[model samples]
Target chain A: MNASVTARRLPIISLQDVRFSYEGGIEALKGVSLSVARGENVAVVGGNGSGKTTLAKHLNGLLKPSSGRVLVGGEDSSKTSVAMLARTVGYVFQNPDYQLFCTSVEEEVRFGPKNMGFGRDDESALAERALKLMDISHLREQSPVSLSLGDRRKIAIASVLATSPIVLILDEPTTGLDSVESAQLMATLDVLRSEGMTVVLITHDMRLVAQHMDRVVVMSEGSVALDAGVEEAFSDPDRLRRCKLLAPPITVLAQRLQAQGVLPKGAATPLQLVELVARVRGERQ
Target chain B: MMRAFELTKTKVRYPGSDFPALDDVSVGADEGEIVLLLGSNNAGKSTFCRLLNGLVPNSIPAQVGGKAEVLGRDVRRTSVARLATLVGMVFQEPDNQLFCMSVEEEVAFGPENLAIPRAEIIARVEWALEAVGLSGYNARSPSNLSGGEKQRLVIAAALSMRPRLLVLDEPAYALDPAGRLDLYALLRLLRERYGMTIIIAERDAEEMAELCDRVILLRNGRVVADGPPSEVLSDIDEVVAAGVSPPQIAHLSSLLADRFPGKTRPFLTTDDAEKEIADLVRTAGSGAP
Candidate 1:
């Protein structure tokens, strides 16, 4: 788990006593605190109304906290323009339709870089890199409306990545994606992490947390319920239940076998079927 | 009862596209049967679903050819208002169909739109909510509910319409594991208890194989395969080529079927696969690899 060492060197983003309420007087975030260091891939997991999206919006200055502070690259987010925030932290909305405003994929990918005042040649270079990163380089001239929903989602992500933000926040990135799209997107996130991009992925998929994240932070009712390594977070099924999440089938089966005396107690969460087979074989050995 | 007799032989062409979204396709569904439509995205799965409720030719831009009937009525001729009473549709995105302030209102919208008696509307709303296991959610706002709750609410709204068939187009695609489980239970209850002919356009091959009585495999708007899910899903290469994720246990069994050929079964659920494996282990004894 890429837990911060000194909160320096990588004090890229931090939330202090953050609270948010909509115009209708509904409190979405309540005194939430979080810190994300540079190069850390931290997954924020929770139920639907658990303030994960609220927390994510704060990271990129989309939704400023009411009574507290949000620090982006050690600068107070409230004082910064969204234009400036977009350069330091890129936010990808869950529904691609909400974000994709351009006509063609190439133009969509170049929108952010162009807005950030890059010249035509530089914008083309950034757009090419982003589209290649998303593996949609061939779709440069295709109309955004003509692409599949999965492809549109990737274009939205590519548009965000074109800005070249150090801290990237994705809200429910895998929603509505088929298994193949989910795998491809997760691989892209893995590559992004390897490139020293700090990623805060907000999602409800525990399998995603188990497979991709460096750390998993559970949120319940607008508060941080559990913050720990992925193993530690997924180990406690009850805590996961409280947060309204479920372990993958393999992990549940392993736990059941352990309970039924077919396997040793304290069996780890098995992410894949091979891991479960290995666990059972080790126990028999 | 609700039955489709050699139905779905329709040719649908989208706007400005020469190719049919669904080519000549035919299938049938019986009352109390859960029929799973398995295919990848843009495989005319959604087009087939729209054909069920007559939304294809009515609201959407499409030219549907041939006879596509639902509940003994020609879908092309049947008005959407009349079709809604026979086949209720729950779309993939719950937000698109929902606009009511409270859960009760959302469910009641269908019955009230049909001009059902207020007393009967309340009763139907209650029964629908109970069927979806959201009995006490009448006072709750759909906007504030979880993704699963909103999905179930959509199902309840369809149920309140007293439809003979329920067509769900990827209703659980956006949900988490627990939410998906809840939706599965709700679908099962609709078929078993209420005798609703449930048609699901799904990508989860294993779930369809286990829960559905029959499977309809569509490819480029054609009925490539139509049979019991066991036969359709057992062909792993076909399912993979169609871009469908095979059931986890079926995948595992296929992996071991090379070494232990007889142990292979068209298993969908994890426990069923485990039981089959355990029984095989006992029979094979030390010969198992």
Candidate 2:
């Protein structure tokens, strides 16, 4: 295996010893290194001010690293312009208001594809599909500014989706959404992931991380504190605590059960825990 | 018994909208109670909150109908500025409420608007910041603070008002796990120590199933279900229909109930689930051959 040949197979997104600092000399990302393979669903979670968002900004060239390199599709991020990178990566803002400025939702969704130089027919097709995916087709005629927060969030996501980027990064997409809306959004993302879209979700909601993401990356103090499979990450509460995070309640319950010898040591979700209990009762009888 | 606030048949319709934002909602809370409002998106949770502080019809201009009385004052009769001194509101976008240069100034803005004494305002600035765990952040720029820190600063601003009622709209939406836990602890402390009544709107009843006094479910701008956590949250069908997810413990208990016949209703909190599991595993261990 030649080193040159192996470098060609670099992850879809990679950060090489990246360090970033704000204008005031405050370091946000301190020598952090990370990578995401093609079509992988990864959750980047941490407390506020932990550099999760900073690390994400580096992926799409929104913020250049102060001391290191970032690679997108085996290309140097520093050499790439944001407009050029927009073809491959779509970054959604946490606050919908920051990105939404169009008078109508339909126009908002079409703005991205049009700006990307898509033809009139291609723009309409993309915008319509994106609107349907977010279940906001009816709201197309309404003003994006006057819509509810949840609807505005959907519009923001639809606008990003219209561009049809292969790699999508959502920052706290479900913070203000209710359970049903969040579930719908996650389900939509799941379908897109199945169609070979790389997803990077920045959120503090561990439940979504456990249910939707296959891998977890914990950030703490401007560094990657832990990166592991989802089950392994949630199983260790001590490691999570060191990073100022906590596993969801169901995971904690599963850990407690494993400690008491009620079952073998393993990670468990809500349904998994219920199944374990029923299996134990069956064996006891 | 004198109630802190009461709304009977409260109905509100925004300008040029077909459906009412809040439709015939009747709910009330006594003094020093922590009531939670749970619902899905566009489910009128925020509308209900705005009505409490007279922002719906007064400032926002909506067609409002209903009797809303807060702390013995009718919401319609009171001016929003006067109501500000009585009802402290923390909007969903808390950053909008913060316009001052520093955290201390932001908290002092509310009390100072009411012409509070200079010494009292100074004392309030210290007490409010300390209450929200921002003691040393007095001089920090509000814009430079993190999202979670900005949320706490707004809460401190609300605390400085010393209002009889507090209506927080998804106050923990931007907070991390530790920050969320801290916010809940602070709310509990307010109710326990200072006898403050808090009405908070939340997306789900996860950790709060064990903390709040009453859980009110809203669906399509109407009151769907209202009861204690164990009674309301355990009803998975209703909670899910109302667009809110029940606590994980509730889900575990519901499944356990289905597996084991004749078990009583589901449990809502992790503590209750822990006790049930300990008894369960102990039984399983004793029968090993």
Candidate 3:
């Protein structure tokens, strides 16, 4: 492999003029074109029926486009087998119950690696490491079916992580999780990104998107309404309103303060917002 | 009237679990009040909601102790069907509860099972749908509705029973922010118009703080904190330690407490925080120093 040639290769996942419709003629994706580079933390956000999930499915070859093309790892996704693509992209469903069927938590996490044809020793190591990363190593012996939703979600992510995919797609991973669990899960994803894994998250939590993700893809009526960096995505109010989304509460506060010239123009997380407010107070005194 | 529901030192352990799902939990809500249950997953919030309608003891095989009462009926003694008449329950997943062909049928299923009069059932079906802002969706298939619509349909079905109290276990789990706002608005409507007591088990304390009259914080199957939203949410350390993040406004107020002195108070919504900050800036600009 030529090092510079490989470095300049196309995006890891690319979709051009992709359109998809369900069996009953319900158009889910109209004409969405997007490109995601390696090791990118991207968040897909929109209203309930704006086709965020549909677009995610195409990236993993779960669904093929009606028109145009989807390329995964520089290969045509539609021509590739989903099983073959599974090694490169691991998709975690929103509900763990939809995918989890193993007897034990350890077995559940090990299933992905085993299915991907890892050796027995490697499988065990991956499973153990994934479980430990998710903070669920203690539940390795427990039945996944008997665990709480939050714990099951962690198990599902661990199972996907055990597969060691370069690209990870999570569909609303924090839907039922509390703030602490959400923060912990995001931290795990951050670590994975640091280790050169690409993460694509589908979520409705603006706070998570603003604080965690580097890029944002806003979907509206099956098309890409806005695709920009985290700051740009939240700062653009018109596009967000067009897609029936709002900036995180902290961002909204910052915007209000900015309007009054109390704070400089910028998007801030809750913690950052506090620091900004304190700085303004100090300046006033 | 007596409190809507009260749990007195209630404890529940599942059939195979070693630890209790709910450990000596005691809480109460008044009539026509909205209570938000804030906790991390497996903190007994669902178990507490189950106890409201006898699902803990009657349906699930659980070791139970102490007392639970809803609408003057002991949950331990009352049949699940009987408790359903007074305590309406909506679960997290709407698909789990919806089975009828059409929205009208789905709404009427609850009342029909209760052996309500046919005329009253029809009236209730109409009333419930209207209350949920789905008045014209009676003939629509539940499968065809959006996630938010399905959730509202479930809420309508629960309301058709005309229960005095409604308990929802993470009802907004599947909804987007817009959908969640609609649901919260509908919940406030339900409380104001129908005088229904509402208990919501939620993870988003920020959104809940603006709507809930009181907040109940649970951790490790125990009640760690219980008070009005302002007081309960303002204790940032306690709330965060319990694995529940306080609302952004509450966090901001706490951060600004030293700077703003006595003016800083727990705020539930962005508008509240904005007003306080704007006031502070105005005072400073007018030569307060």
Q: Return the TM-score for each candidate structure.
A: 0.87, 0.89, 0.90
Q: Report the C-alpha lDDT of model 1 over B1-289, residue by residue, as the tens digit.
A: 5475337567989899978998988778777888899888778889889988989888897988888888888888889999989888999989898999999999999889878888999999999999988999999999988788899899999989898889999887767666776788878878888788888898766455668888888877788787887778777767776777666556665655654456555465668666654544344434454
Q: TM-score ranking from best to worst?
A: 3, 2, 1
For residues A19-43, what per-residue lDDT tens digits would candidate 1 score against the true structure?
A: 9998999888878887887888899
The residue-by-residue lDDT of candidate 2 on B167-264, one tens digit each, is: 89988876788777877898888788778899999877889876799988999999998888778888888888888887888878887777765543
**Candidate 2 lDDT by residue in tens digits, A1-285:** 232443465478889999999999999999998888777788999988899999889988899999999988777889998888878889999999999998999999999999999999999999999999889999999999888777898899899999988789999998777787788888988988888889999999898898788788899999998887787888888788777688999888777777777765544567778777777777776
Off by over 4 Å in 1: A2-9, A119-121, A254-272, A275-285, B1-8, B100-105, B113-119, B133-146, B173-176, B205-210, B228-231, B258-267, B272-289
Q: Which has the better DockQ: candidate 2, or candidate 3?
A: 2
lDDT of 2 at A175: 78
Q: Best-fitting candidate, measured by DockQ?
A: 2
DockQ of each: 0.29, 0.57, 0.52
Q: Which is the winner by TM-score between candidate 1 and candidate 3?
A: 3
Interface RMSD of each: 4.3, 2.3, 2.4
Q: For this target, which candidate reaches the highest TM-score against the unseen true structure?
A: 3
lDDT of 3 by residue, B208-288 (tens): 777999999999899999999989998889988888877777877887775567765557678888887777766664556
Model 3, C-alpha of B217: deviation from truth (Å):
1.8
Which residue pairs in model 3 clash with each other? none
